[model samples]
Target chain A: MGEFELIRRYFLPLAGQGKSRSLILGPGDDCAIQRIPAGRDLVFSVDTLVEGVHFPKYYRPDYLGWRALAAAASDLAAMGADPECFTLALTLPAADEQWLAGFAEGLRAASDAFGLALAGGDTTSGPLTLTLQVHGTVDEGTAIRRTGARPGDLVAVSGTLGDAGAALEYLAEPAPTPDMAAMLDRYHRPRPRLELGRSVRGFASAAIDVSDGLLADLGHILQASGVGASLDSARLPVSPSLARLKGDASVAHALRSGDDYELCLTFPEDRWGAMPESVKRQLSVIGVIQAEAGLYLDGTDCSAGGTPSGFDHFRGKG
Target chain B: MGEFELIRRYFLPLAGQGKSRSLILGPGDDCAIQRIPAGRDLVFSVDTLVEGVHFPKYYRPDYLGWRALAAAASDLAAMGADPECFTLALTLPAADEQWLAGFAEGLRAASDAFGLALAGGDTTSGPLTLTLQVHGTVDEGTAIRRTGARPGDLVAVSGTLGDAGAALEYLAEPAPTPDMAAMLDRYHRPRPRLELGRSVRGFASAAIDVSDGLLADLGHILQASGVGASLDSARLPVSPSLARLKGDASVAHALRSGDDYELCLTFPEDRWGAMPESVKRQLSVIGVIQAEAGLYLDGTDCSAGGTPSGFDHFRGKG
Candidate 1:
């Protein structure tokens, strides 16, 4: 099929699945038009997933589609923004009808889940890669920023971490236990914490998605806010599946491995008490913001020496 | 350098150069925040350029940067929107400092020229590819769409065309005559007709950017508007440098070439008389929209047989 035919057959249906109220024009035009509701700020982010680097060459198209959109949408979740619209600029080695169908199905599922309308994009011929740019909206001055953390703020994380990183071990395994299956699902279909992000908008002083591992991502908040943090190693949230792995190694994964997609937020200590019980139940207070200038783990400075920096595409493992 | 360091050193500077008023936060955040002006609609488009596909394998990085952005931005211009911000998702096999510096320089120059702010994006490891998603603003209900053309509308195009196509033959010729150099420049740096597009906003019934050849793009407008068009072959505008090429083939290029980055518009016949001289000087009225349901070139229906359908990534020669 030609490019237009491919889009019409597979991707065009995805555009109709979850039409955002903001979206005026969807596809088949020079540009997509969207109206930003009054008093809302637009939040934008782009992420690229490359074959063999971000995912295996033969990764399932459906899972790859879900993972790519979920990962990009996590940035908007970090900002406490309402999901609005997204664009996918996909470059593939060839146009495979079956693969396109699977990918589009997965994308449609995510678009519906995230409430992001498919606005516009491009499809090209090249080495397999997917670049997703997501746009969302947040009420004015309510966007949670990395620079908002202050001393005495409690640092909390939503959901457990390390499951996706732990799942990497069983990816090619044909059969797995229930725990392993859950971890694999976590890796393949990580959900963005959109509702939690929206709920914590005015309450959370700072927020970030834990994409580059806990230590690296939280370090960003600290560095940007000009504050520091001290984490109780024992309090770090870990999934039951990940806890069954080699204990220290699984903890290490939680701290150093990326793609968790959970929100790490900091807010005044008093706000924790004020949060509704339903909201508080999903969070674990793992650390506290401090006046000090470095990350501390169990009273030891881990900011420089022996630091496990997050995945850096240029300098670290792909 | 790591991906963050590379972005900070090169891309960060580009963000500082053209800070759009709507931009609240740019790079260094998980997502950039922008305030959309009240009562305006956001216009979006994305384009991807890949190595060995969109351009030569060892094309100049600086020129690639400029061309990629200009190509994407042209869609916004076609919508008659004011350029606001863009996110670039760039993947490269390696982090070469010199190449990055040159690319950033070119991107910065275009950012200033087009009044676009660098927002947030991702850098990854892969075969070199650039995907730019641009966002612009247009007055509510005023965006020019492909469905708006009426039967009696005058079909117009901005600037002379085919210089870029004619220049392709001499791409590898290092030393060239002044005319060849000019054509080469046109290929490398085709300007988006933003001013002309904006000036014709309320008057122009429909508009499209001529990126995939004039006929192919105009066909989009015709198909969407449920209208036909008749072109005067002799009235098609050709650049002086392109006209100097072999006559018949040059005219073919003018009709079938892509990458012109010029605006093709349709407006009522009487609206053409009201256009200011400044805007009129940049346009050529080459055709008229007709009630008949097919494309006609000098009264000859050329919509189907022997038609040049322009570039398609999957079925065409990319």
Candidate 2:
């Protein structure tokens, strides 16, 4: 089928359901039109994932689609923006019918789950790559930013951190145990902390998603806010699957391995305490903002030894 | 260099100048925030260009950067949306500082010329590919759509067509005449008809950017509007560089080649005559919309023999 036919059959159908009211025009237009309400500011970000670099060469299309959208949407979550719409620019080697169907299914599921409409997209021929640009809205002056953290704030992170890194080991495993499957599920369908991000917006001093490992991502918040953090090595959240591994290596994954789409936020001590019980229960206090300007763990500088540098695409594995 | 460093050195600087007022926050943030005024709607479109698939492997990085932005911006013009900001997702095999510098220069030039700010984006290690998502704004209900054309409307196209296609022959010409250089410039820097698009919005019944040849793009309007068009082949405006070719082949390029980025619009005959002289001067009246179901060229069915089927990325050169 031609590009248009491929879109009509697969991607077009994904746009018909769960559309946002702001989306005046969706797919099938030269440009998608959206009308944001008067008091809301528009927030958007673009993320691209290449096949071999971002994902395994052989993988399930549906999971790939889900992972791609979730990863992109995590940025919106980090900004405390309400999910609205997204555009996908996909480049593929060929028009594979079955692959398209599976990918569409994954995309539809994620779109519905994230409450982001499929606004518009472009498809071309090339090595497998997908670029998703997500659009969202936040009340004016309410977006959580990485530059707002201050010294003496409490640093917190939502959900477990190392599940995805552990999951990578079982990416191609066959007939895995339930624990293995759960680990793999974390890698394939990492959830973006949309609700948590929204709930913490007014209370949190600053926020960023943990995609490039805990230390690395927190380093961004530190650099932007001009504050340092002192994280307790034993305080890092780890999933039951990770704990079962029972080694310092698993703890290292939580510290340095990337692809965990959890929110790492800093809140004033009083504000963190004032949060509703239900909201506060989801996060673990891993560290505290400090006066000095460098990351620390267990009273030692992090970069001095056992450095858990985060993933850098051009620089290879962390 | 690392991805973050690359962005900091090159892309971050691009965001410092020519920023739109609506841009609340730009690069370095998890998501860029913008505040669109009430009564204006947001318009966005994404376009991707892969190395070998979209352009020749060996080409000037500056021209490539300019071409990519202009091509994506054309969609906003087609919707009669004022240019505002854009995000670029770039993937490359290696981080070549020289190539990146040239590309950044071209990008900054286009961003300034088109009045778009560099919002935010992603960079990764992979085969060279660039995906640009452009954002603009238009009056809530003033967006000229492809579905609004009427049967009696006159079809007009701005500027000349197929200069990009004609420029392909001189892609690597060792030394060329001024005409050939002009052709190369046309191919490298095809301008988007933004001003004309905005001026014709209220008057034109329907509009589309001529990217996939005049015939193919017009066919999109016909399909969307449920109308057909009849054209006089001799009426197509050919650039002086194209006219010098002096053959049916050049005429064919004007009809069937893609990447022109000109505006093809349908205006009611009465409205066509009412347009300001300055606006009308730039366009050539070449056809008329018809109730008939298929395209025709001088009373001959277009698809029957001289089928200018336009460019489809997966289906090879049209």
Candidate 3:
């Protein structure tokens, strides 16, 4: 099928039939139109996931679609912006009907779950790559940022970390334990912490979604806010599957592995008591922001060493 | 260099040093933030140009950069929305410093000319692909659409057409006359008529940009407006360079060539007198809208014909 035929059959229907308040115009025009509420600012983010880099080419098409949107949505979560709508610019090797159907289903699932409209997008042919741009809205000057973490603020993380990296390990292993299935779920279908992010808007001094490992992404907050952090290795949140692993392996996974999609944030210690109870229960205090200028692990300095780097896609052998 | 370093060095510098009144926050965060003026709505469009599909793999990085942004900006022009910020998601096989430098220079030029901030973007490793999402703003409910054309309204177009296609033909010839250079420039860097588009806000009833040939794109307006059109073949504006082409080649080029990046619109016949002289001089009243629903080229019916299709990347013998 041609581009329009595939989009008409697969994507037009996926744009969602339900009416939306913020969407003034949907697909079918040169541009899609949306109205932001008065006094609100819009958060815009663009992320692309490429096969053989971001994920394996053989990954499930449905999960891939979900993951692409969820990954983009996580940026909005970090900014504490409510889900609005998103555009998908998809390039594929061919228009496989089965694959398109699976992708559409997962896209729909994420759209419905997040209450975001499909908005508009483009479809073309190339090696499989998905570029998603999400538009979200937050009250003026109320959105959380990565530049507000001050010294003495408490550092915390929502949900468990290192599970997605474990899922990658499971994919390579000939036989993975039944318990690893949960880690796989965490990897394939990460729930963007939208509600929790929104709840923490005024309280969270600084926030960032952990895509590039805990320390690396949190390091962004520290760098932006001009502060350091002392992470208590024992307090770092990890799933039961990861906890079962050996000491260093689990610690490395928690601190150095990426693709967790969990939110690593900092806020005033006093505000913890004011956060909604449900949100409070979902978070774990892992560290404290410090005036010193580097990351410390278990009271030891480990900031300037190792491949302390996350996956740098472009550095891969081309 | 890795993706982030490349972004930090090249893309970050091109984000522009101008202080934008609407862009409240710039890159470095998960999402860039912009405030839309009250009583206005946001217009969004995304375009993906994959190497070997949209353009040759060896095309100049500078032209490719300009073309990518201009093509995306054209969509916003069709909506008669004012220029705003944009996000780019680029995938590349490897980072060639020379190519990156050229691309960044062209990007900076376009970003300056359009007054668009490089809000945020992502870079990754893959076969070279560039996806750009442009956001523009129009007064709420005043933005022109493709569904408002009516019978008897004059069919019009802004700037010239067919030079881009002529440029393609020139590219294949290996060596061409100096005249073809202008055509190639049109193909590589056709201006998005944002000023004309904004001027037509209250005047044009229906509008679209000619990316998929003049007739094909105007046909889109007809389809949406549930109307037909009649073109005075002789009146279709051909670029001065294209007008020099011999016989039917020039006519076909004017009508069937795509990537013109010019506006195709319909407006009231009487209201033509009220248009600013500058805008009127720039627009060509090539045809008239009709109630019967199909495109007639100078009284000849060529709707159901041969490879009379535009560039659809997905349908390449698949």
Candidate 4:
């Protein structure tokens, strides 16, 4: 079969099932069709992950597929949109059936988990790359943005941070404990906090997905909101596995290392006590938004006359 | 500034403008928030063009940018959806300011031409590739599909075909001719027949975008519709430029050569004369659908006994 036939056989099935009423048409047409709900806004984001750049070249195809979809979907969650559909633009050097099977299985798992259906996309032969454009919807004027943080908002995050970075460290090195392996799995399969994001619709003043380390991604929020933040280093969320590896430096690693894919958000302190127990268990109050314009660690400015650094696509040692 | 900064400066301005009633929250957020029109279906498609794979490695960056958007937008047009918004996922080996400037210019031109607003996307370090995901809208139960063709329907196509293939030949060995340059331009900047598609909404029984050559792309319509077709080679729309390039073999090029991005559709013979004159100017009756279940060339069955070929991503030679 040709590439088109292969796509029709493998990918089209993924598009047709569990689709929302908004999806008027699925795959098999020139394009898939859907309707945006009235009184809601569509949230869209695209992310590309290339082999050896975004993930290790030796990574399994299944995890690669899961991670790629999660990374893109995380952005939608950050915007407090209900995951609707996604289109995957996948490129590979050659069509290896085993690899394709694994990839499709992983993608299907992610789709089912996230309540999203594959809409339509192109499959081509090239270096291994997966680009996913995810579509979502949120009620009008209710979607969270990066530029809404106020000076007195409480800085918070869902789930542990620095685990993905720690996982990467373990992946790059030799054998590690089972705990470390679990941390690595967290890195590979980040569960986007879709439900929590939706639940905190009116609570969060600002929200961002942690792809680049907290300092850098949150810096975007600070920049857009015209405010700064003071992240208490002692309160930073570092997994026990990471703490075991780096001892006291774990806080620094958690602060600077990225790819956690957790939601970093700010809410008024008044709502903190009313937060759900589940959310409270999952999240930690790490800091507070400040009137000044720059990230800080325990009141001292981290960007004090120095360039802010995290992940740089052109220069990062990924 | 690096690639990320360059993108932030140049491309960010293109987002969050125009009739943004559907946009709840726009650029500068973690993700773009759009409202899917409540009762209408959303149509989606994605296409990726890699340097040296889809276009000539040395092709103009601006044209590359335009063609990439055109290729994806054409899919939406074929689905009879109103052009809306698009997200671009661009990967480059390095940041070249001149290349980026030209590319951004081309993107802006296409966005203006198509009335599609730019959405959020990702930029990364990798082999030069551009993946575009275009989203459009169509009313419920009104969007055309590929599986709607019936037996005895009249097969038609919009605009001339094979010019892009002829253009490829001219680019390979510069047999410089004004007609050849025009053909090359057609390959580089295909105008998607969105208006014609929307106009022929109730008329077309089945439709597809002609990216993988006429016969192969149309084969999709036949398979999905459970019908066959007999395409008259003499009736195949060939430009004056292509007629000069291939002489007697022009028919072969029109049948097998890809990258045309035209529309191949089927309509009931009874509705033929009622088609709009503007659409008639762009469309031509090429063949008739058959009771049998395979594509044909004139009267002979072409599906079973012919060598299947179009654009093969891994094997094609520029």
Candidate 5:
């Protein structure tokens, strides 16, 4: 099929459901047009996932599509913004109809899950890579930033961590283990905490998505907010599936494994009890924002020194 | 160096230059924040260039960087929006400091040339790919669109075509000729017409950037606007260098060969005399938007019912 026909068949239908008031025009134009509300600011983020680097080459096309969109959308959730629209730039070595169908299905599923519509994107011939740029809208001056975390703020995380990391390990070196299969699924289908983000916006002093593991991602808030953190290693929330895989080492994996797509937020100590029930049920108070300059693990300093040791682009497997 | 350090060294400087009022917050956060002017609409477009697909694998890193940004910025220019900010998603096999330096230099050159600032971006490991999502601003109802052309409008083109196509030929099979060097340069470094887009916003009825050759790109305008076009093949503006390369089939290459990043526009016939002298010098009258339902080549119907044979992504290297 021709590029135009492919776009119309696969993308236009997906774009039809975008209900953002800001979207004056979506797709099928020289450019998509959006009108940011008078009192709102536009939040933008871009993320790219490669076939062999970010995911295993043997992974399902549908899962890759879902995970890619979820990864980018998580940034919007991190910023306390309502998901609006996304543009996908997909590069593949060739046009394979079956692969395209599966990938599009996955993208459609994630778009529906997050209430984001595909606005515009480019499809080109190249290596397998999916780059998504997500745009969101938040009330002006009300959007939570990483720089807002203050000393004594309670650092919390929505959902258990380390599951995705364990999944990655399982995918890299699969064993005849049923629990490994479940962990792989969690890694492949990360659920962006959009609802939790929206609910905790006002209550959270600062927020960021846990993409590059809990410790590494939270370190961004600490560094940006010019504060420190003291995370209780005993309080780390490792998923049951991950515990089955790594046993005691699950604590390290939960702290350092990336791609969780959960929100790590900070709230004032006084407001921790007032956190929405929805957030309360899903979130765990993992640590507290500190007054000092480094990270502490169970009252002892962690060797990594609080600097984000997440996935490094140039230096792989950080 | 790690991802953060690489970004800090190469990209942060680019983001520090706040060129647009829309940029409410720049890089170094979870996401960038922007404020679309109250009465204006945001124009968005994304383009991705993959190694060995869009350009030769051995192409200069700096040129690749410049070309990638130019290709995306061209979309905004086609829509007649003032360039704002862009987010880049880059993937590479490994982190090479030398490559990063060259890429950043090229990116900085293009950003400064277009008066755009780097807002934010993602860096990851994968086969080399650069995906850029550009945002622009246009006053309400003033943005040019491919769907706005009507019958009887004069078709115009900004700058000469076919130079880039000729450059591609030179890259694929280098000749022991100095002109071949010039052609390759044209192929690698396309200058997006940002100023001309802003200048012609009020005058042009519809517009599109010529990426997939003149005929193919212009066909998009025809299809979207529900109109047809009649081109005088004799009137196509080919560069002296391209004319030399074409020898006999100059018109064919100009029409079918892609990679030319010029602006193809439709304007009222009467506005020709009122056009700016600068535009007149750089642009030429190539055809007219017609009342008929299909395209014509020198009064004769072309294949696919008047659609010019342009590059197809699925059917490569036709």
Candidate 6:
């Protein structure tokens, strides 16, 4: 089949049944048309996952599909934007019906889970790569920006950290144990904190989704906001599974390992106190914003830290 | 530098100055935020260019940048939407300062020419790849759609056709002829007909950007609208340069060559008369919509005849 037909059959029908009114015209057009509310601001971000670099070739298509959407939507979560639509630019070496089926299923599952529509996309012949562009809408002036952090604000993170990193490690291990199934799930299917992000909009002064390690992502907020964060290593939320697995090294993993897909945010102490109990439970205060613009670990400064071996394409790693 | 820093130093500064009022916030945030005019609907499309698949490895970074932006913007033109903003998810094997500079220059040129801002995007390590997501806005109910084509409407195209294809052929030759410089330019820097698209909004019943050859692209409109087209091979606009080249084969190439980046649209005969003379002069009326849902060429049926081969990723070629 041709590339366009493959999209119509495998991807277009994957659009969720209950689409937001915001998706004016979902798929089947040159461009996906969407209508944001009059006063709302449209927020968008694009992420690309390349084979061998971003993930190994052994990954299941379904998991890759789910990961692609979740990763892209995490940006929306950071901005407190509701997912409206997304376009996929998929480049594959070859088309396998089985792989396509698995991918389409996972994509459909993601669309339904995120309450978004599968918009139009382009598919071409090339090395396996997937790029997703996610679009969402935020109420006027309500989006969380990395530059909104202020000194004295308490720094918080949603959910546990380092599980995905652990999962990656487990996968790399010979004869990986079944006990790490939950961690593997975390790596495969990250549930983006969309609802929590929206709920904390009025509360969070600054926010970012943790794709990079906790310290690395937090540093972004600090640098952008021209503030600093004092992180109490002991206060970091380490998943029980991750905590039970390794020793002090696990803490380092939580601090420096990536793929958490959780939101790290800052809020003024007073406003943080007024947040709903459930919201508060989900958000673990791990640090405090400081006047000095650097990342502090324990008492020492770990600013300009965390896996200094860069994962950037244009950097030394590449 | 890290991926994020590279984007900041090299890409972020390329955002056009005096951004559209719609752009509330640009790069640096997890997601770029933009505010659309009250009644305008947002339209977006994503296109990926792989190192070997989209272009030769030896191609210039500047040309790649321009091509990426222009190819994506062409989708906006097809929808008759005005350019707003675009995000680049660029992956590379390694950072080349010189390549980055040239690429940024081309991106800046395209952004300034099209009047759009550089929104947010993500970057990571991988083989050289570029994914561009372009966003535009069209007033509610004003955006043209392929499905809007009607039988009995006159089919027309903006600018000359098949120049890009000739250029691609020229480039593939061992010693490319400098005399075909104009064709090379078409292949290198396609100008998306944004203004012409907007101007034809109310007059044209349907439209599509000519990328995968005129016949294949027009086939999309025909299929979407459940109409047919009777194309006069002689009436099709052929550039003087293309016409002067290899006779019958050149015209055949005009019909079947991809990457033209022209706008093929349909309009009622009555409405065509109302179009500005300059616009009419630019548009070559090459065909009439037929009751039968297939394409005909100079009284000969070319329904599945133009080119049996598909240029898309999934077909036999891949």
lDDT of each: 0.87, 0.87, 0.85, 0.80, 0.82, 0.83
lDDT of 4 by residue, A1-318 (tens): 568767866677678546654565666677876677678777788899988899988688888878888988899889888888888889988888888888888888898888889887888889988899888888787888898999999999887887887777678657767878877888878888888888788878889998888877888889889898888877887778777766776676677677888999999887767777777787889999989887877766776533455223213211
A185-211: candidate 6 lDDT, tens digit per residue: 889999999999999999999999999
Candidate 3 pairs with clashing backbones: none
In order of lDDT, best first, we have: 2, 1, 3, 6, 5, 4
Going through the candidates in order, what is the number of backbone clashes in each?
0, 0, 0, 12, 1, 3
Task: Give the per-residue lDDT digits (tens) of candidate 2, residues B1-318.
Answer: 778889989888878534686887998989999899999999999999999889999678999889999999999999998989999999999999999999999998998889889999899999999999999999898998899889999999999987888788888899978888888888899889888889998899999999988888888898899988899878989988777764555667888778889999999999999999999999999989999777887786674422345222213322
What interface RMSD do all candidates show, one decimal each?
0.7, 0.5, 0.6, 1.3, 0.8, 1.1
Model 4's i-RMS, to one decimal, reads 1.3
TM-score of chain B of each: 0.95, 0.95, 0.93, 0.93, 0.93, 0.93
Candidate 4 stretches greater than 4 Å from native: A19-21, A172-174, A305-307, A310-318, B19-21, B172-175, B305-307, B310-318
Model 3, span A272-305: residue lDDT tens: 7788888989999999999998888778766664
Q: What TM-scores do the predictions have? A: 0.96, 0.96, 0.95, 0.94, 0.92, 0.94
Docking class of 4: medium
Best by lDDT: 2
Worst 10 residues of 3 chain A by lDDT: A309-318
Best by DockQ: 2
lDDT of 5: 0.82
Who is ahead in DockQ, 2 or 6? Answer: 2
- DockQ for every model comes to 0.88, 0.89, 0.87, 0.75, 0.79, 0.74
Candidate 1 TM-score to native:
0.96
By TM-score, is 1 or 4 better?
1
* TM-scores, chain A, per candidate: 0.95, 0.94, 0.93, 0.93, 0.92, 0.93
Q: Put down candidate 5 lDDT per residue, A1-318, tens digits, no spaces.
A: 767777877778788634566677888777899888898999989988888788878679999889999999899999988999888888877778888889889999998898888888888887788889888999888788999998988888888888887775566663647788878777888889888888887889999998887777787888899999888877877788778777787777778778888889999988878866766788888888888978777776653544553223213212
- Per-residue alpha-carbon lDDT of candidate 6 for residues B93-166, written as tens digits (9 for 90 to 100): 88888998899888889988888788877777877888888889888889899998887899999998878887
In model 5, how large is the Cα lDDT of residue B287? 86
Cα deviation of B192, candidate 3, in Å: 1.0
